[model samples]
Target: MIELSRRALVAGAAGATVTGLLATTMTSPAAAQDAATPAGPAASPIPGAYRYKVGEARVTAISDGVRTFPMPQGFVRNASGEAVNDALAAAFLPPDQISIPFTVLLIETGRRRLLVDTGNGPGQGPVGLLAPTLAAIGVAPESIDQVVISHFHGDHINGLLTAEGTPAFPNARVFVPEAEWSFWMDDGEASRAPDRLKGNFQNVRRVFKPLDGKVERYAWNKEIAPGLVSVGTPGHTPGHTSFELGSGADALFIQSDITNIPALFVANPSWQVMLDMDGVKAAEVRRRTYDRLVADRMNVAGYHFPFPGAAHLAREGEGYRYVPVMWNPVP
Candidate 1:
């Protein structure tokens, strides 16, 4: 057996070890700088890419873009902005505004190129950068073997089509939560939904219409891809799902829309978001899910987190805090 250093032994004592830890330690600072590297006029903003190895697999978080909006009244359905601001203050963020960053991960497991959730498509202001970001990382959309969607929300599924309403990933198979597909595709559900949600219903049809009979609906607790198992996380949308990606003894929870803005939602999970289809259910899921994350010391990749949204969950006073993972350049 290979000898282990005292430090390594202690860090790995829990049967968890990050691959290339030494290389990450040595190159992380430089990597952080590289993330902010200036882009040429024609090049999309430096793709905000981050890479880490999970056992033998390579996971890269590619930023689509970010959107900032004024805090809408009832942004937090159950709490006031002042109350939410306190949570934001604790996270060192502005209390009056919200910034949502979209990130999609590319997982290369030697056998497959899996993309977890496509970002907002080109129409949503500067948020549709996923395509260009992928290009910047030397990955063409067609090269992806699978496109996995966590839900049917516009921001999550709009990127499925291009500006001209074409399949963005021509060669890849698209997989989405069965419940999401069922809910969105139901005319009866759409008819009863509020006016604000009617657009989402139509948008879902527009995005999926071109791919008729091609979309694959997956259920909870199923392995949509190797090492990628879907966990039923509802309320944000009836079918919203989180993923547990395990490789050997390492794992990462892709918490898709579990919380929108970490400063507000993650820090004050009890506070409900207006975007949640079922506010009470969302809060319950958020509280219970985050509690487990804190207790288990799981790394999470949040869809709306800051760029390259990988972080460890830490228990704070009432809720929890997100500890961002340091950048690793050499991986």
Candidate 2:
């Protein structure tokens, strides 16, 4: 028999260990690759909606889908396309692309069910989806007791009427901010407005006309209903409104279009989006409001934020950061 030294034995064992490890390592990646892949067909995303509670109240964030398009010139009136693209890149969003999302909120206070915003519906293409999303959550349009519109923007008020031009929420009392109503309803303002803005005035008339002075006008800081208070956050429009919901110790701010697609505005608060009727005023409101929200660690929901737009704000540098609420399957 050949004489085997202790060193040779150790070397042989080491070699065996190396070979085993190599074999395992060589197959591990492929095995992991196979495991990482989804089995069968790729699963598609379902209708967007999330539920949470405030005291005894129930709130749902409903999506009307999103409209994506190439970043256009003057998308950000204050910032150049290059700067806007840079912000998009930093956020890991595809550069030079824009996505405008619509959110319709549902608030239930035991006896009353209130909808904060009526999203773009079948009436508006390239966007509308709120109807089906609400249905997905078992809320029929007729079940809504009140519809509190945040502004006169088409995205916020379009769903007020169904595809057939009838009141979607037949039994609901539609409440719009009084200031918004005064400005948009003014024929002088409509005529003096730029050609591009004429469409908005026309759309507003188209949506609110069927109601025929029936739409209830609400004032700033006033309670529209129990636990729901209108917060005037103008600049996007003369009468743009947000809302605050408080129940027990829980409170939430429904930030309707305060800053569209936070990747740009919230990340750079001074940068103004083209949608703001008064960019300067909008930026000021954004900074001041966000500062307050950050200081209080307040919860917020944005109409133009990503689907399920509820989030918290953090003061980052001169701007703010949007921290999306964690997905909770169990309310």
Off by over 4 Å in 1: 1-47
Tens-digit lDDT track for model 1 on 1-331? Answer: 0011101000111222334323222112112222345322322233356667666667877777777788788888888778888877877888788888888888889868989988888666557777755654457788989999999887888888888989999988999999998999998999999999999998898999998866898999999898899999999999999999988877788999989998888778888889999988998999898888888887888988886688888888898888887654542
> Each prediction's TM-score against the native?
0.86, 0.85
Global lDDT of each candidate: 0.76, 0.75
RMSD of 1: 7.8
Error of 2 at 315 (Å): 1.1
On the 0 to 100 scale, the lDDT of residue 192 in model 1 is: 98
What clash pairs does model 1 have?
none
- In model 2, the worst 10-residue window by lDDT is 1-10
Q: Candidate 2, residue 12: CA error in Å?
A: 61
Query: Which segments of candidate 2 are over 4 A away from where they belong?
Result: 1-47, 123-126
